[model samples]
Target: MTPSAMNMTKEQKEQQDIDDWLPITSSRKAKWWYSAFHNVTALVGAGVLSLPYAMSELGWGPGVAAMILSWVITLYTLWQMVEMHECVPGKRFDRYHELGQHAFGQKLGLWIVVPQQLIVEVGVCIVYMVTGGKSLKKFHDVVAPADAAPIRTSYFIVIFGSAHLLLSQLPNFNSITVVSLAAAVMSLSYSTIAWVASLEHRRHGGSSHVVDYSMTASTSAGRTFNFLSALGDVAFAYAGHNVVLEIQATIPSTPGKPSKKPMWLGVMVAYLVVAVCYLPVAFVGYYVFGNAVDDNILITLEKPRWLIAAANMFVVVHVIGSYQIYAMPVFDMLETFLVKKLRFHPGWPLRLIARSLYVVFTMIVGIAIPFFGGLLGFFGGFAFAPTTYFLPCIMWLIIMKPKKFGFSWCTNWICIIIGVLLSLLAPIGGLRSIIINAKTYKFFS
Candidate 1:
């Protein structure tokens, strides 16, 4: 045998250590806390901070509806994760592209992942950039009001995002874990901070729209349109499921341990944490602002100079963590298409070239999409909704191959239908808005 095969490799030693640590058990499920925290990490990305502002635009009733619809989309994501695990056993996360291809087809996976990688992931980066920019501006303005400007905000995002990408390429990717943990703390802290701020705002008779459940007993297609349109926003909030694939390679294969539970636990934890974090923020924000809340909550928070710094710090940390997640797919795609497919070698020169391209692309998109809130709305409504909702549902139908279609199958179909209807609703609303005021709202122009 070769020397390498005769000795313990790094991967082998790591696996042995994990096996010793976790041991092997017959349990098919993770403990509640494990499931809870893993999902929470994934959910607390920069998007949660922007949510209250997004919902305020539609009124409290529509905003809450948006939150619930987003959760519905999240439920489908949860179902997909469960189904993927059941079908593929220990390797569901590794074989996400395979699952996509198997469940749908090769072409479908390509379509799904391309936009997922390019638009969804990159768009998310843009959100973080804009959000971070705003947060930094807010922080700076309290101390030096004259120094804040859109250009300065733009510069900060560029520096911040580039630093993350550069740092991620270092040995062991150690900073990723640090950034992730910090992000969790910051997000939770922000939730607490925003809640306190909202309460204080309300105590002083703050006129923000917090309650607007004025639903009419009318089913006119025109009136119900905005509620339907908000489905895309929900889908955008639920788009973190694929994140498991990015970190799946890091999972240790313990000899005695049940393979899938640890990973599944991670996913569920991310979900709960994010859901809890988002809910209160949305509720409190709507309650405080009512109809007048800024599309971004940071704009509406009425805190002292010190508390504002804390909130801004939280936003910055969240953005740092987000860049790591977004970079994974982009790096993978470049490695596949450039180095392997196109026969270019992987080295420092190539890495720098790829990194520069990503920086440029991210900056252009961030600047081009002015008004962070509107960008989220447009992307959520048009891009995220269709990709998350329609594609997944159709793929599940093909993958499950139900003989008589039980309750689970029926529910899956219903979700799919809802997603499709919801995806169509956004553009329909956009079209209607254009028709009403073509000169004013120039979708064509």
Candidate 2:
């Protein structure tokens, strides 16, 4: 230890050691675009793929409205997180759980924020497994001979799941930025391809004879349920809020300005890119396929072998990259718990075994519960509502302590109320849909 470090207390010395160890490299930190790419990559994966199906449920008018509303609310919550991080005294937090501990008490943060964030990350990996396997199978069927025996999606699930498990072994978040950048480009590429394909389909008379744009469902109860479910889908698409702090931590602080400014600029740029990618896919896919769209819009397109194949390839690659990005948090939390709480040293073999097991666990869950839409709704409502919507509002209210009955107070309360309703109603709607479709449901189908 250095002479100055030798004079420090044990706690300060340990903290200093941790701070020195946590950064992936000491040469240079990430640029603004690097942060943007990471954020955009996280925000624009399986969720964007589901937007057309969500739009089908809500129709054009309500669908567009929900998309816009989700964007605004998510952006506001993201900014709230950034603001909270900026307001902390001394050094900034590098993890979401730390920020939670700072805002709420340690107990609440441990019990609430950590687990919810884990769910968001692990849940997303599960979705990626299902999505990757299904997309791979679809692409295979397209090129395979007509007389070939069918291969179950389960096979592809294991294959891609193994691939993801290997990729999950990357040491830290910064190690995966190149993967994240490639995933971001793939996201944009597939989104653009899907959009152009949809437009082309419409030009080639693929548009539905009957295109319904109604805001309400056939029945009042059904309408309410469907609207909430659709809202859940929209919420899930915007669920990257949980990882904003981690992404921000990857970038070095700019000189002579609050770190929040660069963070905010990166976030805005990411959201703008996300909006560009999301709006066209949701709108164009709905326009072409109408209510007949599949949960993954790419599956609905059948023409131009090379183009569709390329898009599906992009989806698979993007998800592979995304699996690592999302899974890193879970790995970090578990490793931290083992080291800090359980008195285990962080070692390479232990890290590999722990992370590999987590990936396998998620893969098993994905294989078991193959109901893609239902899982999205269930987790989005139960976990993401709190993480993405409710908690941020609550944290801001607690930390900022806005005046009672003032604009900020009322707005936050409104968001909180909406989040509660979504949490309760969205699961009901999602589960109802799952039950209604249960007769035809099959594992690995």
lDDT of predicted model 2: 0.80
In the range 139-226, model 1's lDDT, one tens digit per residue, is 7766565554534566666666666556546322222566666767777888778767877878766644355543321456645554
TM-score for each candidate, following the candidate numbering: 0.78, 0.92
lDDT tens string, model 2, 1-445? Answer: 9876676777686655544443232112667777787788888877888898889888767789888878888888889988877566666766788878878888987777888898888889998898888889888988888898999888888988999767877777677889988998999999999989989988877654666555445788887776667777877888888777777776676446656777788888889989999999999888877777877888898878779988998999899888887887777677766766786755677777888899899888888777777777777787888888778899889889999999989988988888888787777777776676677878655
> What C-alpha lDDT do the candidate models reach, one value each?
0.59, 0.80
Task: Please tell me which predicted candidate would have the highest lDDT against the true structure.
Answer: 2
Model 2 has a clash total of 0
Off by over 4 Å in 2: 1-28, 212-223
